[model samples]
Target: MLDGILAARPRGFSLAARYVAFALLASTLNLLVQMAVMGLYHGPWALLLAMAAGTAAGLAPKFLLDKYWIFYDRAPGRLRGLRQFILYGLLSVVTTLLFWAFEITFHWLGDGGPLRYVGAALGLGLGYWAKYHLDRHMVFGRA
Candidate 1:
């Protein structure tokens, strides 16, 4: 039954699977870093600072993996790579807004407990999935 399910995946499923796997790993790291920052800091802006740090920490590896492994984009020029990174950063702003909305909403609803993390997880998952499509067509223009 497991073999049958595995065999029935459509084309590009493996690529998508790998992308999601890497995203999960990166997100986990991001969340850990964010939580650690939050723990050490004590101020009104702590969450914002932590979020920024977490996002920055995870972005580099995610970009590299998405560029080389998922999109297979090899343009062979630092200028082109910089252009791609700029585009990715633009898209990231949109996704980060989505993530922040959910996270802040949850925090407002609940007093910064597990619900906030739940919101962050949901937001990041949705953001990354949307980001994959955007990156595929807009940034990489592969598929």
Candidate 2:
């Protein structure tokens, strides 16, 4: 039964599965970075700083994994990779804003602590999901 289920997986399921796996890794890294920063600092700016730090920390690894693994975008040149990275950054700006809004709103609502981390996780999850489609269609393009 399990083998039948695995065999019946859709054409792009493997790619999506890999993407989700890598995204989870990146998201976890992002949350850890945010939590670490929050632990050391407390203030309005600290929240912003932590968000930015977490985002930056997760960006490069996510980009590499998406480019080389998920999208299979090996175009054989630095320029292509750079252009893709720029597009990724641009798309990420939109998702980052979405993440920040949710995170900030939840943080204020929860009054900080575990709830704040919960907010961050929720925000990051939503952002990464949206980003996968955007990255697939816009940044990396279909394989």
Top TM-score model: 1
Q: Residue 23: error of model 1 in Å?
A: 1.0
Residue 102 of candidate 1: its Cα lDDT?
87
Q: What TM-score would every model get versus the actual structure?
A: 0.88, 0.85
- Candidate RMSDs in Å, in order, are 6.6, 6.5
Tens-digit lDDT string for candidate 2 (1-143): 64353334246568768777888899899989988998899977998898899999999888887777777665778898899999999999999998888888888998865677777778878998899899889987784
Over 1-143, each residue of candidate 1 has an lDDT whose tens digit, in order, gives 64353334346568868888989998999899999999899798998998898888988888877887788776789999899999998998899889888888887778977788888888999999889989998899995
What is the Cα-based lDDT of residue 135 in candidate 1?
93
Candidate 2: clashing residue pairs, number: 0
| Model 1's TM-score against the true structure | 0.88
Error of 1 at 119 (Å): 0.1
